[model samples]
Structures are given as C-alpha cells and as structure tokens.
Target: MELTILGTAAAEGWPALFCACDTCKRARAVGGKNLRSRAGVQFGKTHRVDLSPDTWYQEAHLGADMSALEYLFVSHSHDDHWQPHCLAYLRPPFAHANNTPVQVYGNEAVVRTGRAELGAEQTIAVFNEVAPLKPIPAGEMTVTPIVASHKVGEQCLNYLFASEGKNVLCAWDTGLYEDESSWKFVENVRLDCVILECTCGPSKCERYHMDYEHYLAFKERLEKAGSVSSECIFVATHFSHNVGILHDELEQYFSPHGVCVAYDGMKIVL
Candidate 1:
C-alpha cells in the first residue's frame, strides 16, 4: 500500500491566505513542511478520498491527474472536503484520452449533491452510494467506509482501507470518535498506519477537530484494544492556521511516541 499526502490542513489550511495570527505568521516563516491545504489523499494512482476545493492545486503541484483516479470516497459534503463542482475537470476526454472515469462512493446525500453540482455529465466520474462497513474493491485495494463522528448536517465518514496485509485508518476533520458502534470496527481491525487529525494551535481548545489530548487518548485506546502493531506508524495531519503548531512542534509532541506528522506531498510506502 502506498499513501500520499496531497494536503493536510483544516478547512482554513495551516497558513491562512489572509490570516495574520501569530501561528500563521510563524508558519509563514517556516514555509516548508508546516504549510498545508484542505485535506485529501490518493493510493497508487487509483483510489482517492475526498476531492477538496484544492483538488486542482494538488494535481498541479503533486503531478496527479484526476481522470487517472479510479475510486473516490467522499467523506461527506463539507465545503473543504467536498468540491463536487470541481468535477468539471473530469469532463469528456478529461485532461487526456488515456484516463479512465473516476468512480465516486458515498452516501445518498453526497450522491445527490454531487449530481446536482456536476449536472448529468456522463463521462467525468461515476457515483455509487455506499453504507458503512460495506467493502468495495478498488484496483488492488479494498476500501470500507466507517461512520465518522463529524457534523452530520451532511453525511460524513472516515475510511478503513486495506491492501495486501496493510490497513490504514483514515481519520481527520473530526474530534474524538463519538459513535461506539463505529469504534467496534476500529477495534476489531488491526492497522499498519493511522492517519489522524491533530488540527490545533499550541493553545487552541479541542472542538470539531482533535488536539494533542485526543491524539494521546486515541493511541492509548488503540494500544489497549490491540488494534495496531508494534511497527504501526501514526500520522497526524489536517492542520488549521489557528492551531499554530507546525511540523517540528508536532514532531516534538509526537515523534518520541513513534507518531509522524504529515506534510503536503509526503509519501509513505507501506
């Protein structure tokens, strides 16, 4: 399994365009690994998560093609997470002729919103409404949507993706797992990596996103439940400018405990 971090920031991103906050200013100073954008990821050029408003930015900067992506999992319709309107890029003949159609999987609401936004375009991407725990195959991987503990004004999800013997728990844009039933799926499945959310400034309180406190708690719970391996790696991402902490700050907090803080364009081969 291969994981790529195209973007790893909260809705506003780590260094907000017009933000003049201390954290944002600090991030600007260290403009490398600390910089982030709306979150998203891809696997081996085929499967993907959400299509953020920054989708084109990711493609341009990361050298990825939207038409080449085969499976897209919409984690819900939050503005930062869902940019169905962006699918216009997937129109007929797409950026190139060799590209295949992108297949999107999500809930009824997500499908409805995607269709409404993209119109009835028949060649961009295909949509499939899926429920939690229902596994679907994508290339050489199998993806299972897990009910997420996020604002459900629209449906949201975190995914459990497994390829070969490697499994990754895709988590972000939400605080602690609020649903116990979903915790069961997390507990029962062992994972090789955990892509978690740590969107916080050094002083920000935890809400709608996880902070260091929740991050630690998640580690403790996973250890107790034996849902991870000794070699299991933890990845923290989804940064917000308000959560002024940067990569080194996060490494200071996470590395000693064997966790990794992700950066835009970073890739991990599992």
Candidate 2:
C-alpha cells in the first residue's frame, strides 16, 4: 500500500489565510514543506482519507488525479477534514470520464452531511455509514473504523486499513486512547505504519487532540503492547499553526524518535 500525505496542516493551515503571526511569517519566508495546507491523505491510487478544502490546490500543485479516487474515508465532519462542497466538481461538466462512483465511508454525521451536500451528484458519489469496529470491504482492502475521542456528541473515528499483508493505522483528530475497546482491538493487530496527529505540538493537550509528548507515549504503549514492531514507520502529521512551529522544527524534534514529520506530498510505501 502506498500512503501519501496530501496536506499536513490543521484547520487554519500553516501560513494561515489571514494572519501575521511570527510562525506564519516564517513559513511564508521559507516556503517549502513549511508551507502546508489543510489535512488529507491518499492511500494507493484510489483510496483517500479526509477531503479538505485544499483538495483542489493539492490536486493542482501536487499533481493529484482525483478522478481516479474510488474510496474516501472521512474522520469526522470538521470542515478542515471533510469538505463536501468539493463533491460538486465530481459531477456534471466539472469532471468527466469518471464512471466509478466514489464510495464514502464515515459515521452518521458524516453520511448525513455528505448526502445533504452531494445527493444530487449520486452518479459520482455514494455515502456509506460505517459503525465502529465493523470491518467493511473496500475494493481490495478491508477498513475498520475505531472510535476517536475528538468530539463530545459526534462519532469521530480513526481507521485501520489492512491489505496485502500490511496494516495501517490512521489516527488523527484524536486524543489519548481512552476507549478500552479501541485499545483492545489495536493490541491484537500488527501495524506496519501509524499516522498520528500532533496538533498541539510540544504542548500537552489531551482534550480533543494530542501533543508531541502524547504521541511519544502512545508510540511507546503501542510498541510495548506488541501492536507496532521495530520496523514499523511512525509518522507525525495534522499540524496546527497554534503549535508555533514549522516542518523543519517538527523534524528536528521528532526525527530522533524515529518518527517522520509529514510534509505535503510525502509518500510512504509499505
């Protein structure tokens, strides 16, 4: 499986749309991986996680071909992660020669919102409501949703993707592993790659998102639990400008721990 980090920044983006903060200024002056868009990831050629507002920019700048996308797994209903408005382009004159409808999998809220926004474009998009822990066949792969502690009343989720003897854990917009069921489920699975969010950066916040410390702890716990092996690749993504750091700084902090700080267009093949 080939996993591509389409965009790495959190909701507001790295060099936020309208901000004069020092971090944003630094990102603008040193434009490379430091300048990031909203969060999204593409798995292999046809499957993707999240649909940010920056999808068009990523497609144009990163040379992504969205027309080939067949599966879209949404983490939550947050605007930065799930931009249903972009589905309009999947239909009518905007997109052509795409006979395959993109099967979108998500929680109740995500399904409802997607249907409300893209129902008229049923020819190109289909929403499938997925429950936690239930494995669903997606093309050649099997995906299981894990409950995430990101929202109070919403059923936000992380995902476990298994294919070709490799497993991937996409854990974003989540705090610590407070759910015992999720922990137990992951404990028995061997993960080749784990994508974790460092939205709080160096700080320690466990309310809705995790920080660098929390990330390290989680990695340690996973390793100790035998879920992740020595060869497992750990990646830190989903950055926030409020974290007050750029890609280079993040690399400097996380590199020694064998964690790759994800930048836009970064790809990991397993």
Candidate 3:
C-alpha cells in the first residue's frame, strides 16, 4: 500500500489565512514543509481520507489526480476536513468524462452534510454512511472506521485501512484514546504505519487534539500493547499554527521519538 500526505495543516492551515502570529509568520517566511494548506491523505491513487478545502490546490500544484479518485473516507464534518462543495466541481458542466461516482464513507453527520451540500447528484459522488468498528470493503482495501475523541454532537472517526496484507492506521484529529472499544479495536490489529494528529504540537494537551507529549504517551501505549512494532512507521501530521513550531523544529523534536513529521507531498510505501 502507498500513502501520500496531500496536505498537513490543521483547521486554519500553517501561516493561517488571517493569522499573523510568530509561528505563522515564520512558516510563511520559511516556506517549504512549513507551508501547509490543510489535512488530507491519498491512499494509493484512488482512495483518499478527508476532502479538505485545499483539495483544489493539491490537485493543481501537488499533482493530485482527484479525478481518478474512487473512494473518499471522511473523518468528520469539520470544515477543515470535509468540504463537500468541492465535489460540485466534479458535477456536470464543470466536469466531463467523470461517469463513475466516488463512493464516500462517513458517519451520519458527514452523510447528511454531504447530501445537503452536494445534493442527490450521483454524477460525481455518492455517500455510504458508516458506523464505528464496522469493516467495509472499499475497492481493494478493507476499511474500518474507529471512533475518534474529537468534537461533540457528532461521531468523528479514525480509520484502519488494510490492503495487500499491509495495515495503516490513520489516527488523525483525535485526542487521547480513552475509549475501551477503540483500544480493543487497536489491540487486535498489527499496524504497519500510524499517522497521528499533532495539532497542539508542543502545547499542552487539549480534549480534542493531541500535543507532542500526548502523542508520545499514545505511541508508547500502542507499542506496549503490541499494536505497533519498532518497524512501524510513525508519522505526525495535521499541524496548526497555534502549535508554535515550524516544520524543521517539528522534525527536530519528533525524530528522536521515531516519528516522522509529515510534510505535503510526503509519500510512504509499505
């Protein structure tokens, strides 16, 4: 399986749209890895996780062939992650030769929001509502949505993707794993790669997102539980300007911990 980090910023993006903070300023000046748009990942060439607002930019600049996308797994209805309106571009008049609908998998809120925004038009995309812990066959991969500890009133999700004998855990946008059900799901799987959200960066941990300290503890727990081995690739992504660390600094801080700070366009094959 191949994983591509399309975008790696948190909700507001690195060097946020309206931010002038020291970290944002530094990121803008430094460019390169620090210059992120939003969080989104593409598995192989067709299956993707989260349709960020930066999807257009990713396709235009990062060479993402979204037109070839077949499966879209939305984490939640967060603005930074779920931007269903972008699918409108795939609809008639705007798009041509896109006959096959992209099968979208998500929870109730995500499905509702997608139908409300993208309408019943099956020309571009279709929604297939999913619940936590249920494994569904998507293309050549088996995807299991796990409940995420982020936001109230809606079920946010992390995903376990198994394809071609390799398993990847997309643990983005979640806080500490306090749910026993979520932990039970993790314990049974051997992860080849784990992508964690370090939205809070070096800051104090929050209820809905993880910081560096929180990530370390979580990784330690996973390792101890035998869910992740030393050979597993640990990646940190979904950064925020509020994290107060630039790309280089993030790499410096996490490298010793065996975590790769994901940058846009980073690719991994396992």
Best by lDDT: 2
Pairs clashing within candidate 2: none
> Number of backbone collisions per candidate, in order?
4, 0, 0
**Candidate 1 C-alpha lDDT tens digits along 94-146:** 45634546788987888888888777684676778997888888778889988
- Models ranked on lDDT: 2, 3, 1
Q: At residue 249, give the lDDT of candidate 1.
A: 76
lDDT per residue for candidate 3 within 128-211, as digits (tens), equals 999789999987999999999998888899999999988999988889876789988988899899999989888897689999
Q: Mark the 10 consecutive residues where model 1 has the least summed lDDT.
A: 91-100
Better lDDT candidate (1, 2): 2
Candidate 2 residue-wise lDDT, 1-270, digit = tens: 887898898898889889999999999999999989898888867888999999999889986667788999999999999988788787667778464688999999998998888766676788899989999899899999999989999989999999999999999999987899998888889999999998999876858899988899889889999999889999999888888877888889999999999989998999
lDDT of 3 at 6: 90
Q: In order, what lDDT does every prediction score? A: 0.81, 0.89, 0.88
Off by over 4 Å in 1: 201-207
- Supply the TM-score for candidate 3: 0.97
lDDT for 11 in candidate 3 is 90
Candidate 2, residue 222: CA error in Å?
A: 0.4
